[model samples]
Target: MADDMTDNMLILSMISQVFALILRSSFLSGGLGDA
Candidate 1:
């Protein structure tokens, strides 16, 4: 059970990192277009 929980945590962290990168990229593109 502990190992499963750690695996889930790792996946969640990696997903969050990817999500954040996507958001940052979108924001940058939008800003550049607007400017």
Candidate 2:
């Protein structure tokens, strides 16, 4: 049970990080394009 919880937390953390990275990149690209 503990192992399963840890795995789930890790997966969630990875997904959140990926989402943040995508958002940051998109914002940067848009700013660069405007300039």
Instruction: Report lDDT per candidate.
Output: 0.88, 0.88
What residue runs in model 2 are displaced by over 4 Å at the alpha carbon?
31-35
lDDT of each residue in 1-35, candidate 1, tens digit only: 99999999999999999989887887888854653
Which of the numbered candidates is closest to the native, going by highest TM-score? Answer: 1
Model 1 misplacement above 4 A: 31-35
lDDT for position 24 in model 2: 85
lDDT of 2 by residue, 1-35 (tens): 99999999999999999989887887888854653
Error of 2 at 34 (Å): 11
Task: Please give the distance, in angstroms, between residue 25's alpha carbon in candidate 2 and its true position after superposition.
Answer: 0.1
